[model samples]
Target: MTKIKIKESKASTSIPTANPENLKKQHRKKKRKILWKNKVKHVGKKKEDTKAMRVLPPKAPQEFSSNWKTLQELLKQKATSFDKSLPVTQTYSKNHTSKKENVKGIPAISGGGKMGKFKSVNKMDCDPAQTSVPLATLKSERTATDKNSTEGKGNSKEHKKRKNSDIEKEQADIKHKRRKSEEHMEQHLEADIWFDDVDPDDIEAAIGPEAAKVARRKMGIEDKPQLSVEQVLVKEKAFAGLTKAVAMDCEMVGVGPQGEDSILARVSIVNQFGKCIYDKHVKPTEKVTDYRTAVSGIRPKDLKKGEEFKSVQKEVADILKGRILVGHAVHNDLKILFLDHPKKKIRDTQRYKPFRKEVKSGRPSLKLLCEKLLNVKVQTSEHCSIQDAQAAMRLYTLVKKQWEANINAKSKRKCVA
Candidate 1:
């Protein structure tokens, strides 16, 4: 009775449940296949192409929509500044193809999408990259120079030319010279020249006063200051340390106004700095008066006959050359000397006497200055070379101090600094 009514039932087929493990295994196999494919690509031509395809900075994403059209414009723009090598390829095809050939097309693009706008893509399309100096900039630099400046030259060439000129001038200045010039040049160098270890035979032995009578002469010597002046400037340090002030007490034969009566006899040079470089009893040019034996001390027996004044001129000049000149009145001493010896660089304490207002004027005697200033008498018994040199040196330093003080005051700098 329960089965009286027969009802037909249509059942829908149910989908089988997926096995996650089988799905996982299949997915792993697919992943392995993809990985193997990539590995092969990495090991093959892709590796070789890396060295050939130099990496470039990424291109900016397309900024404009019709970017395909800009490729031709860009190419043309680039070509204007570079060598042109374009291959406009045209392909002809089958029936129903239009008689008109199509030029290479620039790929079209839509903007605002994930894909950026594209450029021309054809069989003949090629990437371009070449480097060169900008012609406009190079031309601008050339125009700016225009011979007013050396654009392409090295600075070394100019420096070498100037250096050579300086060298040539130096070489030319060294060849020629004169006697007076040499003396002036070495005026500041006299003290530096040494006489140590010289031959003893050069030393002279002469009687008092007569022994030092022949000390200066007017022999021919050049007069050029340039050589020695430059040398002093270059070597001032050598002269600066010379504390020894050498003085020459020169005695010359008396001369008349016309200088015709050349009574050349005795000349002496005594270095006031305890040095006696020269002392000689020069034979007289003319016969001596018999009355001079006691005072002049020239005995007829001791005189050497035929001793020319010219023969002894050089001996005297050398003695007086570098040292300071001192006497009662050095003017008379020089006047007597210039008759034979050239008046080179000679310093007279007498000329500086005017500065010593306390000292008597009108050629005060050397003994008087020594007695007053130094509290010592000179030439009382015998003319002492060392004593006279000391007096002259003292007088020089006193004057020098005054001069230095004046210079420091003018410059507003400390003296002896």
Candidate 2:
């Protein structure tokens, strides 16, 4: 009965059906699964490689040989040889020998001999009668010896005196020659004038009436009297009304320790004609801390009767009113006076372009500009307010035409714009 059922049960085989859309979908799904497995395996391999590289240690740096070591070894060998050649201990010979030779009549003493033996022999050979001689004879011999010594000493003294006198005379002659040479040099200095190219007549004409008089006196052409400080201030007040431009300068003294705080000590103003219009010493409001005599040239005696600050300020303001102010670093002077002027009317020689060729932005010193442009040496020792003001005015005069033209051109352009 079981055989009959087994014969009827045969293995059944199923076959897939072909559809273009369904086959394409199956192939895509299979490709995706294979790619995902390959990606996972590749990532695991990369992680294992990184772990192996991290576990290893880094290599150490190698050392290099030095060239100086060979040189040092050679030097040490030479030093050792020099040390071996030197004697270890000093020794003396048994015989006593002198490095100098003995005289022909002199006898050499034995090593064990004493010089006292010769001295005793000399004492025994002296005659007793010589010691018993009269005191008159001894005195006469002493006087004769003294006279001979005195004559010899006098001759030597006279010779030394003659030598000293000769040396002194030579020194005096050299000094006289040096003085003459210095005098000659001074004469040459006077002859070689600073402004040789400029005509003295033109300079005389350009100067103010007062300045021309002073120049003439200096040049031995006139005998005009010099003006006093008060007289000059009075004249400046009268001239300020007619003058269109003025140059001013101020000297300051220290009012605090270390000379850090500046206070007005002196003020000087000059017109375009280069004549001093105002020159006065101003007393500081604060207590005087430093006289600064070495730099300001203002001594205690000069400041004894100084004018009040307010009065000086009033006078300066009146003179500078409605006028072109020309100066080197004029801002410092105005600031000290506690006054303010229009910037358009101010001309600073320190900021002038032609004067700043060597230094592009830095302000050149007044002394340097005077020496270079005007061929005049200024501020050689102490500073003088009148001299500085005159220098500023002269510098302005040198380029006055060009400077005024530039200012007018700028004003015209501004108005047009």
Candidate 3:
């Protein structure tokens, strides 16, 4: 094969330049962008600094002008502070006017005849000794005058109306920005106190007699004729009607290997009239694992001196037999005693429908029941069996009619079935 020689095509080696008009246009566009950015930044800065440019109300120049000599003397007294504390005066008209009003006797090098501007002061015209009032005294007087003016303004109903109207306008504006629910809540935020004219009977009707008593106590109001604590706790004589109804409470100590099992430690029975019928500490058959002294209020000494469990059980059974048994969680009490009672005759405050409803929970404690229904506090620190029994009996008495009627209605229905 023969090698063939070929000539190369000729082309320009120089780089191509852009159109001059296009370059000019690009340059103009670049310049405009920079100028626009600069303009935007300047506008934003001015908006932020608007507070600095705010105009204040013009002050009377006569106050400072008349007391120029006294003011000069005052300035001289604190020359160091006056020189050091001299603020950088703004070029704004408001700032100039304020400065002129403060030191009115000073001559202005420029802008003397303009509106809100002060003329030159001649120091020679006024005698320094004419008004001998000290600057300190004048300042105090000015403060007193200002206070008096504010008080006088506050006393005026028209001023009050204007202030209230202004407040209402602001509130209306805010309400427009908020939701209807928020406005409703804002209306409720305002609270009024009228303790002086509050009748405790009215309060009792509204809240409860117990809460009313508390309110009355706080207000230093005289209490109504009520039973004393001793009287409430121990009645002089038991009511004959309460013999059939009795409330019993048991205090138990922990037993078994883990101390979870409960055994009867003490027993208390109270009649419907808040009178204790029977109270005794019972010695447990099993060895006590936990005394539960914090809650049960039973000590080792009490248990040592307690009666036999069998004897106490028999006594309790005899008292509770064929009677309306009132207790908080009476099932637990009966279980601990190893005895059974008729369910129809049992009035357990814990299981009561009305009580559970008020408590807003299925299991209501003895303390809670007493507080809610009887408006009495019991078992505050240590469990008092007698107090609890009394509380439970009182609770039963509160709804005795409704409770008995319901029981009768249930029995009748059962008989029909």
Candidate 4:
């Protein structure tokens, strides 16, 4: 029942502030004490009794005294055994010799197991008759044998030479017979005449004298006199009035879709006189997909040094400017060139009614027209653009007057209407 009042401790109510540096120093000292305690604990305890911790004893130095004594004893024993195994030859005293063996040297047994003594024998006593024979007879026999052998060898060599000579003679005879036979055949055969001999006077009577001379020249019955170098150097005839007309032919290659698309590969142009005016290989802008060589005669190598498409187009356009264009299929060529020309200025051999018998609808190919009207063959295998252009120009020239007259009449009719 007694209640006593006690004072509260002030230390629990207020917090004390210490310097940071001093607190850090005290902390380091406490850490050092802890580390020192750990180090002492580690050093004071004994290490574990492991095999790795045991110390090995040092090895003793080697000595060769006992081994050397043993090796010397083994060598001495080997020498005694080798001497005991050797064979020994027996010796007899002079008093032990027999009287029969005393007449000669010691008798030795040979490999035949016979007791004998080596003795000298007289060579003359063996065969007295062979020695008595004269040396001249033996020399003659040897000489006879030598002569027989030499004769046999000589016969063989001579036979070989005779056989070679016979073979050569037979070959020469055979060659001579062949030459005779060839000469005989040549003498019997007659020369062939390619053409029949047509009388020039008769030819002149049938046609004209000029026509006869042409026929004689073609038949090979007459030869044209060779021209001199000056005549050979003469230039080709200039194209006079046909400056405005040029026949062009284009060769196309395939580019897309199984080579179905046509791309211009080469172009050939000829004047009215059938002389080459312009010829060029045109490189396509797009990659070449096909070379229609069989029909177009344009190979891959032809376009290796070809001009660019734009440059070629410009050159061709400049050449064709304000000129009458003549071709087999002029429209198709213009389409491939991406060019346009006036309808009146274009002369298509394909559409010319006079070239073919069919007046309407069907158009004849330039090759067919050349064969029928111009009497010239073209496009036999691979089409040559230059040859085709020339053929087209020839066909146009053949009917040039009639074609122009018909065209003029049509124009006049159109103007009147």
Candidate 5:
């Protein structure tokens, strides 16, 4: 009626088990008087309570295999990407890891239903004759060995002993910190390549006249499709209100050799809501500077004599009459138009993120800002005025969304309190 944990070790070669037949015999012997009074047949019905597993000889040998078709398909399609950038870690010194060095022993069993005789299962033997060993046993053995050795040595090197003790203490501390840190760092693993080619320009062709009003720049460029005013209006309305601002960027050639460079190329802009806008490029009076040319992708030959700047500036003012002026570092844009616009209406994101002095990642380049904030990568290989302008607008709207949300939250809080 009681469980007996009879252990088998060097003293015995075999162990006893409570098999179904043995158990049945024991039950019949124990309640002989009750069984004799009420005799039953073992013929028809099965007992719901007796759901014991059938005893049989060990299983026969077998082989296992898996399909290799999936592996072959994966090997054929080797791909590459550079999209694994992530937030930088705080510090290298904070990183740590640790593992268990010891396990406690299992209590000894003496005819009770308790486990005993733990064995080391740490790759002790892969053979079929292997037995499960409790980790506690190995830890105790290791501890005893160290204690006995230390007892035998009367005068071990003091310095070496002290060094070992210090190292062990340090390891324990590291283990504690590592355990704490691991919980917060459960994240997706990733990798990337580090390469920096400032600008790899092959051609120096001056940028052609601002995209022809009729000739769609979208047709020629694959990455940057020119958006019509109608398309822009639709997109802007879909995201925010119809009262939107436009940021037009025009890059002109620089004329200078030794002194400060002269404006050889001009980027013009017009911003307005529900109105046609004009953006134009002007031919510089002198040579385009090396740096300016590299950035704007405008060559000495692209700025041709087609329309006068005086005529273009008038259209710029007319288009930008109703809409707000938006730009990144807009002083240059306003100066190029030759009409120092009012400071009140212009919104410069350069005054904020991705360009602010505090944000190290924010670059003066529009493409980088667009990529970092909007998750949309603009032209990086070549400079496209239309693409840059659109990117600025997209970036502005993204920033405004956050700004508006914050403003509305504060307004509500003020009203409630």
Candidate 6:
């Protein structure tokens, strides 16, 4: 009886079923898209991390792997142009091994299967630590070794002699390069030798108008550039270290008959920074036979307002005590002052072997050294003891490291003995 109302419906009564194969295809496509997006995100994050890590301090070997990989990549790229053969290492054995014995092969990739959980067993064999020596390099090295072995088969002594000669040539080339480098350094350091602290008026009064003009330009009296905080700090630090070292030069006036024997007339001392620390004219005990007006710049009036010789000597001794004394012909200065300083405590620019080598003279004068190494001409007219002292100090500063090292080494040896 319900068939009377159950006319044919427009919509399908049976539930529509999805195709299993189609469903599987759609699912795989969705999964593939998701995986691609995740991979891109992961790579972007890794790149960002690498960029951030660049500014940080280098991590310990165990703490970093990405940096090691980057270094390896750089080395690999450089190897294309700057390929260098690795030095061969030999292992002494009871059974003598052949010189051309093959390097032990790196073990194959281990712990790489499903059973191994895909974890690396040999850490050193990992990508970061693995040797990236090119196949071509190995082949070339093998051929080179073979060639050497064959060549030395008959004339080993001649080969050895040739090798020794090559080594000697290499040493000579190294020495030449070193000499050139030192000359270059001297040229560059020329600007640093100028006495910046010396007053223009003093230069004019002591030397001449020409030197004073040069000093004015160098000192930048009119157009001195404002120094930044960093520069000022650096300058202060440099000058602070100069307190331990001082340079002295004494102007002598001839006292004995024939005007040969000299006595100190004017003494000038400067610090490492070329700043005058002590300057005073001394009233000599012996009567002056020759004032040496042209060289010493010590006029009769200048010595009229001079300090007593005994007082000057005591003051100089106090200042020089436990301090490095640098000067040209320092022994002569000490002799005239009637003071004794430890030989090790003195740095004589005149006797310095390197300075002598530079001038190519047995005893290079301070003026010659100043002109040659410092590129500053001094003693133009009247010799200024202050200027001479500054020159000696600058020369000492040039080889300060080597000079101190020699003194320290000698002292250490003496102590040990």
Clashing pairs in 4: none
Best by TM-score: 3
Against the reference, the lDDT scores of all candidates come to 0.46, 0.69, 0.73, 0.68, 0.50, 0.72
Better of 2 and 3 by lDDT: 3
Instruction: Give Cα distance to truth, residue 74, candidate 6, Å.
Output: 99
Which residues of candidate 5, in runs, are more than 4 Å off?
1-244, 264-277, 286-292, 353-364, 401-417
- TM per model? 0.32, 0.46, 0.48, 0.44, 0.36, 0.43
The TM-score measured for candidate 3 stands at 0.48
Q: On a 0 to 100 scale, what is the lDDT of residue 151 in model 2?
A: 100
Predicted candidate 3 versus true structure: per-residue lDDT over 1-417, tens digit per residue: 999997654433232234577678878999999999999999999988996665343255544454455545543433333444565553244345644454343323233322333444433333332323345655775676579788888789788899999999999988787877765654443222235567877787556665566667667887777765446545575573348888898999999987899998999998878787789998878888899999999989999999998899899899888888998888989998899999878888888898888889899888777666655667789888888887787778777899899989998999999
lDDT of 6 by residue, 1-417 (tens): 455566665455342335577678878999999999999999999999989655543357774565355434433433332323332332234114322332132223333311212222232333444323334544565577578778878588888889999999999999999999977765554454476788876665455555666666666666334444223212243453347889999998988897799988988888878777899999878888899999899888988899999999999999899999999999999999999998878888888897888789999887788777755677889998888887788788877898899889988999999
Over 4 Å off in model 2, which ranges?
A: 1-106, 109-242, 358-361
**Full candidate order by TM-score, most accurate first:** 3, 2, 4, 6, 5, 1
| Model 2 per-residue lDDT tens digits across residues 263-381 | 99999898876677789998778877888887899877777778999999998999899999999999999999999999999999998886788334477988887666665677889
Check candidate 6 and list the clashing pairs: none
List the lowest-lDDT window of 10 residues for candidate 2. 90-99
lDDT for 307 (candidate 6)? 93
For residue 128, what is the lDDT in candidate 1? 26
Clashing pairs in 3: none
Question: Best candidate, lDDT-wise?
Answer: 3
lDDT, model 4, position 354: 59
lDDT of 5 at 45: 25
* Candidate 2, pairs of clashing residues: none
Give the least accurate 10-residue stretch of model 4, judged by summed lDDT. 123-132
Query: Roughly what TM-score does model 4 have, to 2 decimal places?
Result: 0.44
